[model samples]
Target chain A: MIIAERKPVDEIVEMVSGVKRVLVLGCRGCVSICSAGGEREVEILASLLRLGASKQGRTLETIEATLVRQCDREYIEGIDQWAGQYDAIVSMACGVGVNFIANLRPLDVVYPGVNTSFFGGSADQGIWTEQCAGCGNCVLHLTGGLCPVARCAKSLMNGPCGGSVGGRCEIHKEVPCIWQAIHDRLDRTGRKEDMSRIAPIRDWSAAGHGGPRKQVRDDLTV
Target chain B: MSFTPDIRVFCCHYTSQQAIAEGLAGLKNDGFPPNATIERLLCSGKLQVSTILKAFEDGADGVCVVGCPVNECHNLMGSQRAAHRVLAVRKALNELGVEGERIEMFHLPRGFHPEFVEAVKQLDERTRGMGPSPFNGGTAK
Candidate 1:
């Protein structure tokens, strides 16, 4: 899932400060799973904005709506009638959702309520950590099912760097060195022989380095 | 008219509410104000941030969530989850520039009527000192 965190309320308030009517849009997608934007979050944010505005002797009208998945066109299409009613919108979704809504309704001004972080999973309730970089490649099978690209501090594909000490990353004591983890796993799986074969230089074109990526499937396309 | 703060207390049914009922029965009037209202929840863990904000939006000066003592919760970790949720909501309140201390959590043992009443009294006193919610008399709801 994509990980995200709510932007500071002060920044959010500044986005729709002058607008009398603001719609708070939430997504039940990745943002909801991470607790950044959901039905409950939409209500909480709307209430906070209203309360914050009230303290300044200004009245703010906030409406709450949660889409099934803001990244999907079908889900956001039904909101066509409601989109025109608000002066501005507060999008409590990932950057994709916010951009999707903006593209769907060009007339409404949309402000992001959360900062899109990375492709990750929940470490625990209310805690999340990045797990994947979506490099358009999979190297887990070669490295004991752990992608050093996402886990390593330096994204090294070879082995542990000099910075890895005591099985922890030098940059942060709390972070477990993924290279060490990979070594242990390879040893346990009797695949330590695979480590001796040096890997060739990786291709960078598949990782969105060239430009904005586009995918087309002739079988699925209309 | 003298100012009286409105405190909304959400009590979990099994433990906290049991104590609150016993406490209310033993008191004639005591420290509770006229606006103090108790809402019963199956478990305090189910308490959402929206509910707390809604209480303040509806003019509550203070909000309290009382649940079973940490490990003694009937729903396993419901009380613990409630504590975490309360802390998160308090942080959000602070970010909104409102008094985060206006909301509190009390982990009360079963049949501890006196402690339950005492917790409510603390909330009442603290709320009185803070006057009304900043959203009061405003068109926020």
Candidate 2:
């Protein structure tokens, strides 16, 4: 799932400064699950905006709406209900949702309320960790279901880097050495032999390094 | 002329039972600030950051949250959750250039206790010094 966190309220207040009316948009997708941008967050942000505006002796009218999923075209159409009611939009969705609004509604002014962090999963309540780099490659089978590209600080393919100490990354004691965990996981599962094979050089094209990446399914396309 | 701050108090059911039982006159006799309004909640954990912000948006000069003592909450971690939510509102208030102290959280024992009144009095005093909320176009006194 895509992980994100809201930008500071001050920055958002400044973004919509002088705008009399604004739409606070939310997405019920990965961001909602991660608690970054959801219906509840939309309400919080809208209220904060109004409070901030009031503090400045300015009145800001905010319209709150949450789309089922802002990434899809049909859901993006839900925004039409609030068309012309707002002068600008404060999108609480991840970057993709913000882009979808921009791409579909070229005339609308949109501002990102949250910063898109990475493709990750909830580790616990109120906690999320990056799990996939979306490098257009799958090497989990070779690493006992762990991807070095995301978990490993250096994304090392083979063994632990010299920086690993006591099974923790040198970058931070809180970060476990992914290679160490991988080795232990493989050993416990009787698949340690998988580590014996050397991994080949990785290709970077699919990771969006060449440019924006796209996928089209001929069978599903109209 | 003295400033009477409009303080909004949100207290959980268990912790605020006594205050609710006291009736308005009894509370006034017990020194409850007349400017403060008490709202009872089933559980503090059910409180949301938006709710606290709404108080300010609705013209509250200050806000206070009273919940069961941290570990003694009837719903286990309910008060703890409320504390976290209050902290979130405090951060947001600070971000908006308002005094974070305008809102506070209190973990107190349930039933009639002087601490409950004391918490309200403290907030009332603090808010009185702060004058009306910036949202109300008043500066700190």
Candidate 3:
């Protein structure tokens, strides 16, 4: 899932400073699971915006709404119900949702309320950590179900770097060395020989190095 | 003219048992601030950041959350959860340029106790020093 965190209230307040009425949009997708952008977050943000405006001696009218998912055109269309009630929109979805709203509604002014952090999963209750880089390539099968591309500090395809000490990354003491964990996992599974197979130099084009990535399914396309 | 802060207090059922038992008049007799309002919940863990923010939006000069002692909550981790939510609201208040001190969390023993009233008194005095909430626009409600 994509992990996001809300932008500072001051920055968001600044974004909608001149707009008397604004839409606080939320997405019930990955962000909702991560507790960044959801119905509850929409309420928190809308209330904060109003309080911030009040503190400044101005009144801000907010319209709060959450869609099933903002990454799809069908759900993006749900925003039409709010129509002209808002002069601007504060999207609590990840960057993709904000872009979709912008791409589909050229005349609408939309602003991002969250900083799209990364593709991650909940590590624990109220804790999320980066898990995937979405590099458009598959390497998990070769690396004991762990992608160093996302977990390693240097994205090393081979074994742990020299910076690894006592199975911890030198970059941060709290970060366990992913390569060490990969090696241990393979060893425990009696697949240690796989580590001997060196990874070849990789192609960069598939990992968004070529430009914005897109996928179209002819069977599903209308 | 002296300023009277409009405070909102959210307490857990277990922690606020005394207040609930005393009724409004009894609390007044015991020196509970007349300007403050008490909202009782089954557990403070149910308190949400949005709820606290809504209180400020509704003209609360300050907000207080009284929950069971951290280690003795009836629901185990309920008070801890409430503490985290109050911290979240404090961060939001600071972000909005309001004093984060406007909101606070107190973990006190259950049932009737001076400590609960004292906690509110501290918040009341603190909020008085801060004057009316910026959201209140120098008006007391």
Candidate number of the best lDDT: 3
TM-scores for candidates 1 onward, in order: 0.91, 0.97, 0.97
Q: Candidate 3: DockQ? A: 0.86
Docking class of 3: high
| Model 2, span B104-123: residue lDDT tens | 99999998888888899999
Decide which is better by DockQ, 2 or 3.
2
What is the full ranking by lDDT, best candidate first?
Answer: 3, 2, 1
**Model 2 DockQ class:** high
Q: Name the regions of candidate 3 deviating beyond 4 angstroms.
A: B138-141
Steric clash pairs (candidate 2): none
User: What would the per-residue lDDT of candidate 3 be over residues B1-141, giving only the tens digit for each residue?
Assistant: 698999999999998988988988988888888889999999999999988988998889989999999999999999999999999998888887788999999999998797888889899999998889988785322
Alpha-carbon error at A13 in model 3, in Å?
A: 0.6
Give the per-residue lDDT digits (tens) of candidate 1, residues A49-160: 8877877778998889998999888987867758557898899999998899889887778899999999998888778888899888788889998888999989998979
* Listed models, DockQ each: 0.57, 0.90, 0.86
Worst 10 residues of 3 chain A by lDDT: A48-57
Model 2 per-residue lDDT at B82: 97
lDDT for model 2 comes to 0.91
Give the Å error, residue A33, model 3: 0.8
State which candidate, 2 or 3, has the greater lDDT: 3
